[model samples]
Target: MAYYISSFISPFGMILINILDGGEEPALKLTTEVLTGHVAVYHGDQIWRVEANPDWSLGETAQALSDLAFEAEIPEELRTLGIAALQNCVSDLYRRQPFVTA
Candidate 1:
C-alpha cells in the first residue's frame, strides 16, 4: 500500500492523507478533496460519495471512519490501522512543510 500525504496550513492546520493499494492517482487526487470537506470511500468495487461534516475535527474524522467500517464490515483492527495510517501520513506531511518562525 502507498499513501500520498499533503498538508494545508492556512485558516486551520489540516492534513490530508490519500491511501491507495493500487496505482490509482485519480483516487488519491479525489481524496484530497476530502480535506476541503468531502468524503469519498470505496464501496462495491467503486468509490462511493459521502457527506462530510462541516466541522473538521479528529472526532468527526474518527466517526466517519467508524461509519464506513460499519457499512463495509471492516474489522475493528483494520479500522484502527486505517486511522493510524492516516495519522502517520498527516504527521509526516506536517513535518515536511517548512515551519514559519517569527
Candidate 2:
C-alpha cells in the first residue's frame, strides 16, 4: 500500500498541492492518471523538460505526506499510516530505478 503527494509550482511560482491515497486500486488508478496529466501539462513540449530520476528520500516523503495529511484533515494515526505507505513505495521505486538513490 502506498500514498502520494504532489505539488506543482505554477509558471508564476504559485504552488498547488494534491494528496493521493494509492493503497486502494481505484485511488491508485486515479492518481496515476492525474500525475500523468500533470507531467504532460508541466513538462511536455517544454525546453526545460528533463527526465530526472525519482529519488525522493524517506524524510522528504514523510514531510510531503504530513503536509498532505494536514491539508486533508485526516486523523493523525491514518496520516502516519499514509506516511509509512509512501516511504515503502518510494523505497520500491528507488530499487526499481537502480540509478536512483534515496
Candidate 3:
C-alpha cells in the first residue's frame, strides 16, 4: 500500500509520475505535464490520455486537475488513487515555480 510521486522539472514545465504499491504487479500510475495540463493514467495493460488544455492560468492548477481527471477514462477502481497522484504533481509544480537560467 505504498504510494509516492516523482517529479521532474524542465524549462518548459514539470512532469510528474505517481507510483503505487512499490510498482509491482497491479500497479497504478498517473502522469501529468503541469503547465500543459496533459495527463496519462495507467491501470493494468491500458493507458488513458487526457489532452492538454490550451487555456493557461497559473492560478487554476486545481481546476486543471479536475478537468484532467474528468477527461481521463481511468478504471473506476483506480480513479481515486490516480487522481490523487495528479493532484500531488500539480501541487509540486506550483510550489516549485520554474526558473530561467541566464
Q: For residues 1-102, what per-residue lDDT tens digits would candidate 2 score against the true structure?
A: 344655433221122333455533222110111232221111112211122123544334334434444455344544455445545555555576666443
TM-score of 2: 0.37
Q: What is the C-alpha RMSD of each candidate to the true structure, in Å?
A: 6.3, 11.7, 5.4
lDDT of 1: 0.44
Candidate 2 residue pairs in clash (backbone atoms < 3 Å) = none
Off by over 4 Å in 3: 9-11, 24-26, 33-38, 54-65, 70-78, 98-102
**Residue pairs clashing, model 3:** none
Local distance difference test, per candidate? 0.44, 0.36, 0.53
Best by lDDT: 3
Reference-based TM-score of each model: 0.42, 0.37, 0.50
Superior by TM-score: candidate 1 or candidate 3: 3
- Which candidate number maximizes TM-score? 3
As for candidate 1, its clashing pairs are: none
> How does residue 53 of candidate 1 score in lDDT?
67
